[model samples]
Target: MKRLSLAILGAAALSAGSAIAVQATAIEVTVVNDTAVLETRMPRALSDYGFFTDAAGQIPSANVTPYRLNTPLYTDSASKLRFAYVPKGKQAVADGEGLLKFPVGSALIKTFAYGEGEDRRLIETRVLLHRADGWLALPYKWNDEQTEAKLALVGARLDVDTPEHGTISYRVPNKNQCKQCHSIDDTVVPIGPKARNLSSDWMAAMVKAGHVDAMPQGTGALPVWEHRQEADLNDTARAYLDVNCAHCHQPQGKASNSGLDLRWEQDDPTSVGIRKRPVAAGRGSGGLNFSIVPGDSSRSIMVHRMGSDNPGVAMPELGKTTVDKDGVDVITRWIDAMPEKTF
Candidate 1:
């Protein structure tokens, strides 16, 4: 009887272990092409790869972390992943695809993963061209198949030997950092359709704008969300803010602070700070008055809320753990972008 009990216990343990191994998780990568002039030129975009599962829509009982890459370039002598730089304004039109114009003088290289997830994939990079002519931001684009995407900019360097050793040194941003800001959205929906976990409003707009021919709609399976290089700030940055702050600052949100709102397109300086007094009466009422002190972010209560450790003072109250360094940098840059004079 004792022997029989031991066998049963071992069986139970194995079953539990198998179940734990199948838990699902998100996978992402953010490569910083240091070669790019401005960080802004590196398109800050996230594309959702479909759920990886076996027979069911569940993660396989295998190690997934091995798939992570820390370099901007991938190579496989066995596969054909070539690295090349194409000038911008020059259109590379393939038979079935649309004209993909490299942003004048920018270049890129392609390589394949030798070990895992092997396929001839692109590792395109570009630099933000800030010249007397025009300041060009980062360019990025996504294809329907998440597997196929490209990053293009105004001036980029490829096939150059750098101390980093590889074609590009990749820096993968923390996932929770992104989740922190995105979690703040009212509906918790991503801005773009391909990246969105729910709904397709923006996708419809893209179709309307002639950015794409049709909206991606299918229930068969989650399609690969291709990344679009060279996306406008209106679509990418604004969408990011919407998912990150709109929930607490919108008219319906909990923060009715001094009538200031941070919803998408609500960039009015006067509307961003204290009109009469602080929202919670005396809390952080620095006597300096105004909610967002016009141009000086240091004097603004809104900016203060971002770095505050106080439970009562932190903006987007519940997502502190997820707010990583990258998210903080992006927010700071955005605040800095605000005009000096109240508009």
Candidate 2:
């Protein structure tokens, strides 16, 4: 393994109290290039790596304090566990809009696993490393013995079964596929770590720990979507769409030409695609007339795309190979409950 060292100095200027010359030594700190080494092979156990504080030796790394998104990407039946760690002396900052800006040397790890207990299968662990230049997305495929995972650039396709979704052709996206969703404005950024998607408790903790400067106040404090049974159908569905589709459907996203913005903050019904027709949808529209149809999910193109697993017509063009029935159901119910017209 090779190591690279980086030293950064604070730029705050020192001022003398009187009319006298002042001299000071610039603070210098070195950071070990852990991302370089971890990119090669996945550790036999999550604890083998120092990315998290684990005491129970859990497969998902117990002390990592798993975080959830209001809306999450659907990847068949594989459950995902995500963890993020910032380098010592560094912290993630928030953009003007409250989006988290992870510092260079930060790493976000997500593991996709299937089944449970002895029959459990660790599919792959994807890592997003923030370097001085930019972010790098790397995927590591787990071995059959469940001992280790190795870097896999080309990706893989496997026939796997999930108790809920049954057997399906699962595809592990290649490096290029990762950039397709992660890149916004031509720069790779995290899609799920936005303040709106985080729980309030988690956000407060991050602020108190100095991981982020501050969260937006008042209306800016977005609530995390709760389980369907506990939350309003409309809110749950909107949150789902925000996480799963808004990344590409927003005004500045790759699919912006479609005229649909699924972001949570968009309040205008027309802009959010309610009763709005698709733009240049072609076959992707499934012959539907509108993106959403008020009270009819059956007549909504968005619902059609969400329910379809066909490569040519799915809402998301990548990362998923099967229909997310629960997600579709939630959205459908929301549409079903909408009034035919809103003045």
Candidate 3:
């Protein structure tokens, strides 16, 4: 990405006995943005779209703005730096507690990194482009030198040492897998940027900037993940499940056949995986009876599958190779906190 910055200055003079001159800074730096490149073509390099100011994809252009979700999806605990860009003169429409309906030519950029401070390394950057046809997802792998990132159309796997799971083979999902996670009723859609999950501060800023049409009804409806311990138990656990598992577990998702709906709005206890027997007899479980047994997590099949790393048995089956102890702990506590119904 070639970003050029030019400083322009001007001087104004006023008529007086002795003419006085005042200098003013006209403009700072003009951002290089080619909206046409974003709408068409699948270039070999991520920089071809001209989204970032630098080759590392750290500095965004003027049109791009960074954003974060209150509760994010956990993908092997990768530190996801999210950003969004909309074509000038176009604003995203706020859906009812759902995803912001971004217009065509909008782009969602996410860079997945690992490690802390100086040791940090960006493994990949995923882009979701809103084309005239539909949303398309692409993965670009970063180089060892931490420079430019190239599109990995087929995806890649590399062994890396992680803070949580030690040295494990990390899978950068292929284009088809991206379609799988984003698929909603056979149409690819974004899972993040939901109105309820956005922070109030971000909502206000986006509104003020005119990027978003207006503040949605339920901004910050989900508890912040960092301060989740201080929030309501049920709400926090459900939020985690919504971000992490609900994409596939909901009725319109790929895992609809399983009959467990973990969406935050789902109120029914049975639908939310309590006292509900497996739709499929075994369901790749260890002969567990219910998805969640009130006041007992060990017997709950949800917890059982979540805590496992087995290929055919893990709950999510994608995004995570090892277990999320904190997530599992929260769900476990939530289940344990439930009072068993007395017959």
Candidate 4:
């Protein structure tokens, strides 16, 4: 009887070990590109790429790093969670103060959310895949259950409650519309992830982790949005414009024809919209002459269009459907502080 009991105990221990092994296997993470999916048809579901460890929790899997921009693009004040997934054996390269060049088969994931604390709900996740041919932009809309995000080729509109604006129609840009803000020189390129716009600490850590090849030089610091009051006014305002408008206003961008270069590196006052005239005359110009009029925020075309609710008059024709009061306030403060000048 004692011998029989010992054998049963040993069998139980073996079963427990087997269970432990299975649990460990279940928790192992996998994060990398799906080359076949990238090179071929777009994946119908975001889960098909295996980017997240927990979709509901917004947790990224192994090799996927979460990062934040010093000053992010304001999309109706939506909270954004961003991640970069660089494949094994490949690393991202810093390109001056411009965007980091991700190797082929890498991907960028961004989830836009709304609400506060426990009530926060994810609205959409936009992915930019770096394929052998070029970058591909795809937007995914999260389900009401928050379990999965499915491909939204044509995009969707939903009424979302925002802190600044009450319930408003939030836009999830279609694949084509995604190309508009992301495109530069007719090529879809990432506007964010510029070394200058990123935290120096974050960059250093990435280098230490061997995920990035080198720490970029000449990356002038962009002010932290949360700590902008403590930072220089010029730095704060320029950083905001660079992240929000420069992608489209730069010479290589879709709005290149407008001749307004709001890039952080653009030192020219005229290019930065100090008494610069609008390229065309229309209601979009708000009957104002210059894009920015120093010392006169009220008369500045930038402020008028930015403050306008009219679709035709709003500065950013896409991505924004409501007026950005906080953004307008920042620009207004900058313009108001500028010494009065005339063209």
Question: Compared with the true structure, what per-residue lDDT tens digits does model 4 show for residues 115-160?
Answer: 7767989999999999878999999999998888999999999998
lDDT of 3 by residue, 129-212 (tens): 888888888889998998888999898998877887888888888888887888899788899999999999998998898899
Off by over 4 Å in 2: 1-65, 208-210, 215-226
Candidate 3 at 328: error in angstroms?
Answer: 0.3
**Candidate 1 vs candidate 2: which has greater TM-score?**
2
Supply candidate 1's per-residue lDDT for 18. 57
- Once model 2 is optimally superposed onto the true structure by TM-score, how far is the C-alpha of residue 293 displaced, in angstroms? 1.1
lDDT of each: 0.35, 0.69, 0.81, 0.83
List, residue by residue over 1-343, the lDDT tens digit for candidate 2: 2112211111122234321121122212222246562453433343345443221212222223356665577888687877776665667786644468888767778878887766767788777878777887777777776656666777788787777777878788877777778888767777878776676677677777666667634312343444567776677888788888988888878787888999878899998888898888788788889989999999999999988888889878888888888888888898989999771
Which candidate has the top score in lDDT? Answer: 4
**In model 3, what are the clashing residue pairs, if there are any?**
none
Report the poorest 10 consecutive residues by lDDT, candidate 1: 64-73
Better of 1 and 2 by lDDT: 2
What are the per-model C-alpha RMSD values against the true structure? 20.8, 11.2, 6.5, 7.0
Encode model 1's per-residue lDDT on 2-24: one tens digit a residue.
33553454455456675333223
Name the runs in model 1 displaced over 4 angstroms: 1-238, 273-277, 281-288
Q: State which candidate, 3 or 4, has the greater lDDT.
A: 4
